[model samples]
Target: MIEILDPAQLPRARAVGALVATILQTAKARCQVGTNLLDIDAWTRSMIEDAGAESCYVDYAPSFGRGPFGHYICTSVNDAVLHGLPHDYAVVDGDLVTLDLAVSLDGVVADSAVSFVVGQGRPEDTAMITATREALAAGIAAARPGARVGDLSHAIGTVLRAAGYPVNTEFGGHGVGSTMHQDPHVPNDGRPGRGFKLRPGLLLALEPWVMADTATLVTDADGWTLRSATGARTAHSEHTVAITRDGAEVLTLPPAA
Candidate 1:
């Protein structure tokens, strides 16, 4: 179900968004070459409790995934892109890591993800990460009120395809507010002027991801994990936005950082 928050609920939405953003940013800053995946999960747990928020992932069980995600954050490295379930592993220099986070505060939810190299990384990996960010921005730009879902998808797809990257849209963005994933699935590529029309008070999360070589995907042995189809590097970037009467407002930007 798609939710359109009234002014009263928008504040809670903003609070949830800020919490998600700050936690992810703080965790991203602490990740290093020697960081342990479990440690990262612990840190995320601490932050979520400190804020009196609930993790959208900890007990998450979707038909597509193994029951109970059991992790506070998604730690995707190199070949792992989406649905990355953290495991017992130590990050190595130049390892590409993507942190996907979602939290609910005061009955509202916000979700976002960021991809970055652990340390000094290969140029190709660096470029791929940047491309995902660029595509994310384009998608948000197309999320204004009166715009169609396909418009946003098309905007993101244009950027990724132009950069010579493959978009595996099996998993993309979706309606977000009282819950994590809602109706109106936002694909990474589509024809413009199609699909759900954007309306005021609607909240949507737009994410754009790309694999270096192929547009297919493979789930890992863990069942909750998703990796690049061709074992190629992948990157993802996302943001939670609210559709305003005039346009779109990104509710997840942390304080200037």
Candidate 2:
């Protein structure tokens, strides 16, 4: 369902967004060569409880995934890109990690994701991560009252394609508000001047993800994690944005220290 949040709910949205961003940043900071994926999940759980927020992923059960995600955060390493269910795995140096988080606070929900390398990053991986981040920015920049969903998608695609990465539309961004996923599926690539028209009070989670060499994806044995078909490294970047009278306001930015 498409939900246009009221001004009264905007503050709740911002609060949840801040929580998600803060948790992601904290998880990223603790990622080390010997860090365990389970530990990250535990840390996320604690933070969510301490903040009096609800994890959108812990009980998530979608058609594409196995029932009940049973994890607090999505820990994607290397080729693993989307829906990365946390498992028993130790992070190694130079491992590319993507942390996707969503939470509900005061009845509002926010979602965001970030991709980064653990230790010394590889040139290609760094470039791919930069490309997703740039695409996400482009998408947000295109978001404003009266803008069409295609406009945002096109802007995101232009950046990813230019960076020589294949775009995958199977899993992309979506509208977010009281729930984690809502209407207006925002693909990573699309033709401009099409799809849903942006309006004030609308909230969209614009994510731009890409596989280094191929667009195809293969599910892992766990039936949750999605990895590059060619075993190529991947990256994803996302943020929850609110359509405002002036422009798009990013709700999921990390809180300033």
What RMSD, rounded to one decimal, does every model reach?
A: 0.8, 0.7
Model 1: lDDT equals 0.91
Per-residue lDDT over 122-188 for candidate 1, one digit per residue giving the tens place of the 0 to 100 score: 9999889888889888998888888999999999999999999977778999999888999899999
Question: Where does candidate 1 clash, by residue pair?
Answer: none
Clashes of each: 0, 0
Rate residue 233 of model 1 by lDDT.
Answer: 89
What would the TM-score be for candidate 2 when compared with the true structure? 0.99
Would you list the clashing residue pairs of candidate 2? none
Q: What is the lDDT of candidate 2?
A: 0.93
Candidate 2 ranges with C-alpha deviation above 4 Å: none
lDDT, candidates in the order shown: 0.91, 0.93
